[model samples]
Target chain A: MPAETTRAANRERLAARRAAEAAARAQAERRRRTVLGGVVAAVAVLVALVAVIVVQTHRTSTSANAAVPANTVDGTVISVGSADAPVTVDLYEDFQCPNCKAFEDASGRTVAQLVADGTVQAHYHGMAFLDTSANGRYSTRALNAAAVVVATAGPGAFQAFHDLLFANQPVEGGSGLTDAQLVQYATQAGAAGSSVEHDIRNLTYGDWVKTATDQASKDGVTATPTVFVDGHKLADLSSAGLTSAVTAAAAG
Target chain B: MRWNAATAGPWLGTAARLVLGGVFVVAGALKVPDPGAAVRAVRAYRLLPESLVAPVAFGLPVIEIAVGLALLLGVFVRTASIAAAVLLVVFLVGVGSAWARGLRIDCGCFGNGGEVTAGETAYPLEVLRDAALVVVALLLARWPASRLALGGRSVAGTTDRKEYSRAR
Candidate 1:
């Protein structure tokens, strides 16, 4: 009888020990989970706060730098209309941008009409956001070469080169324009001799391109085909909107 | 009964992380070249009130880069995966909304000037891709594949067995 009683006591002791271990484990797990939750919440809050600070900094910088004029930078000139026209429309474009091409195709004729009538003057600055990407085929080399062609060959050559580049934009994200292709486009634009080729090969006007791009950035211009009519930026560039902005600029 | 954890290897998780990270890196890099175009794309969404557009546009690429870096390094795997999944879903919704409204603007996923057609059909494909990513994320949330990660390898491996049993 004592042996059986001792056996029962041993079994109860084991049971109690096991229960205590299980409870301790459960408590530890709960503590771990609570600590993890707190850490995650703290990390999330930190990330959110950092994001807010960075955003505010960007906003402040952009607004602070917004006062710079778009056209004050000196660069290789690429003009589509008469230089002496009463109204000047400054265009910042990227060759890889479809909308810029669309704007050119859609409004090219109207713009030409206005230019020819001596009602408006359009100056284009080839910016290269698109060419930096795999999708930016023509905009890369063609834009650079066009700048040199304009610098070496003159405004007429620039206009002709611009038209050809737009007309012959390659498939998006394809291999960009080759040197031969650039020479071909430049030749078509009436640039002859080793001078134009040298200028392009040496990237002589590269500084001007960089300066133009930096100026655009300082002026808060972010997209291609950003048109500044006279000194005022247009709110939108839909066909009607552009026409109205141009008219207002001309009137002003 | 023995508990069976999902037997899929870590390759899928690794591949998903790499691909998603690559996509954001490229997207962010493209925008850094032309912030104005980025701002324009944000405006085209018309989702934010006008006041918020510039702020979101300027900072989104930086956020993308940070998330992409975290994902690629496999640090904070669960949190980064969840954030990435949520971001893709939001983008999918924005794309869908724009397409439905017949806006012929670019998706601007990569950057400004690389606009895709706003065809309504593309939205579904984008959403489907994001949904697949979310499933991958859930898997990561479960298995945590954190052996290769920076923050929680030991803890994850230890907890994984218990979680796997409980789940079963």
Candidate 2:
């Protein structure tokens, strides 16, 4: 064999090896790109699904609270006793809460006596924070029923209806009083046979209860049976402890 | 590109993935029915933006279910594993922040979590659990090998086969 021919054949072998290596590298790169594209698509799909669910939930939950009228002090929120009473005690409660019932049973009489004497006016803030406890949102319904009384009857009738609800408070974690029971209680308290019964049955203030609960939460009232005087929470909710706090606030 | 022998052991990844996947499915399902509870739980954390609270409360469960299903099926294992890892890291941060702030909130991972008055908060245990899941996620991202994977291909050409077993 000639020396030049031998050298040319070696060069040809080297070139062929380089081309094969390049093709393999390109194939590997293509595979990497494919995997990247697939991963990106998968993640995007998951995000889109999440976005859809978010929009739907926001729509339903927000609309559920938007329709009801705000009924404030005159027609919305309930107030007991003289609006110009020297002292004001605010009570925040959830209808389904066991502790609220205990509070009502323990200190309710003292409050009523104070109201009778015109020494203190009470502002009852109804919340539906315990909506998750019952399958049908009984706390909201009960509060809305109470709202009916406040709207149709005067403060005197509302105070009577309030006692009736606590006297027959439902067991914690159970489905609370039905619409019929709420209406019956209102009638028994002499606060019914008017729009009060209609509102109780129709749950006209259901949205209001939810709004009130949200407002309470924003105001740092996470737990139930919270009692306040002049915007300061009373640590101790016992009848004696509350009376002292009220007396001190009134003196101040 | 190449085999992931540095943090190898596909068997461990498989075990971890299954356990974590099951955890997410259960957690998401529990929160699905009670969006109100979910909202309160998120609010209790006090970590999210006010506007984001409602969306996060409702959307998180759906994402968890999707990620759990993907992991269990082993479809898009690498992507799913990465997603799991990211999510676990986020949860770890959230739990750690809550613990640091001394916030008395249920993690709401399982359910019935909201503003608890008096209860033991297992924030340490919860953080530890999430950190462990994060490690599993990294393992799967590195070497996503497990039995019965639907796609059978992970990280391009790798799968739960002889090659994966020998990766260690």
Candidate 3:
């Protein structure tokens, strides 16, 4: 009987050791799998991040090299009105923005009046931040066309083209306008030369639009139709507000 | 024929995996097309430095897509789930900080995010959504076993609730 009991005890100890070894083996396998998974995830994330960075860098640099039109003041702004005007008004506007269109409707004449009276100099910095909203980048294309007008047809044509764009501003979240319509508008706005057509179709001034938009953001121009009167942000973007701001700045 | 954790957990995990996977993929895809807009949205947060914004804008969508694909394919569910939870927590913090700072901005969870009008900020809803997603992600992390998964058998077997008990 004692020998039988001893045999049973030995069997119990052997089974316990086997179970422990099995668990240990399972744990080691799990740890290996986890490490493998971690390696896979890390490699994927790193490769993806590097690829995006390279692509983004290429995109920005290519656009950065795009030629800035000769007429832009300091390589980004299109200056309108007398150079000696007492007040400086900087307008940051995106062609695809409805708010920008509304701002134009509200203060377009006031701006024209101020410019004509030689009381203010208007610097228009066109932005294409809304390019994503429209198919084929209406904001960038329209702004590029405006820049083309400035370069080929001078400030007068640019001013006319600018007004025409906002006046016929396409509804947001759709293709804003066709290149054909832009060309027609340019013609009606008195823009001449075949370069206007070539540039508008090819987005010759696309780089300038991107540069101007980036500059606007750096200059704290967050939203569209942002108006700065004598370097101060005009909070109220109304006709009266613009006029009063201009009058006060001119008075100073 | 009773529905219990062992019987029902995997199906629930599968549904969560698909939902989170779809959300991340769509979110990343929407922002990937317009990196500039994504950059602008990040800038609107006013949290990251100017230099870091572009890198974050470019890198984030890629990470989201990779993680999303991993989740959707059910390959490495635990790892993907943990990554997803981390991302959701980060978003929840971003939304919460924006709310606390009184900065009226969009969460930019999808594509069109930036400073919105004062009346347009949806901080509470964004925070709630992100927080809930974070919970779902953590739950998936805890129980990685989901039906129809491709490569999570070993990973899930280790943490699958009933499996753990049965194994013991």
Considering every candidate listed, which one attains the maximal TM-score?
A: 3
Native A-B contacts reproduced, model 2: 0.15
Q: Which scores better on TM-score, 2 or 3? A: 3
| Cα distance off (Å), candidate 2, residue A20 | 9.0
What digit string (tens of lDDT, one per residue) describes model 3 on residues A1-252? 999999999999999999999999988997798688779778978987899887876666544357888787988889999999999999988888888888899899899999999999999988786665436788889999998888887888899999999899888878779999999899888886687899899988877777777777666555666789999989899999999898898888
Clashing pairs in 3: none
Backbone clashes in model 1, listed as residue pairs? A135-A173, A222-B36, A222-B37, A223-B36, A223-B37
Candidate 2: deviation at residue A228, Å? 3.0
Q: Which candidate do you rate higher for DockQ, 2 or 3?
A: 3
lDDT of 3: 0.82
lDDT of 3 at A106: 88
In angstroms, give how far residue B39 of model 1 lies from its true place.
Answer: 6.5
Q: Per-candidate DockQ versus the true complex?
A: 0.14, 0.28, 0.38
Chain A TM-score per model, please list them.
0.64, 0.78, 0.94
Q: Select the stronger candidate by lDDT from 1 and 2.
A: 2
Candidate 3, which segments miss by more than 4 Å at Cα?
Answer: A1-16, A63-65, A132-134, B74-79, B96-105, B112-125, B138-145, B150-168
Clashing residue pairs, candidate 2? A71-A76, A72-A76, A72-A77
TM-score of predicted structure 3, chain A = 0.94
Q: What lDDT tens digits, residue by residue, belong to model 2 across residues A113-204?
A: 87777878898877775664463778778888877776666667678888888888887778788888888988877776767777777778
TM-score of chain B of 1: 0.75
Model 2: CAPRI class? acceptable
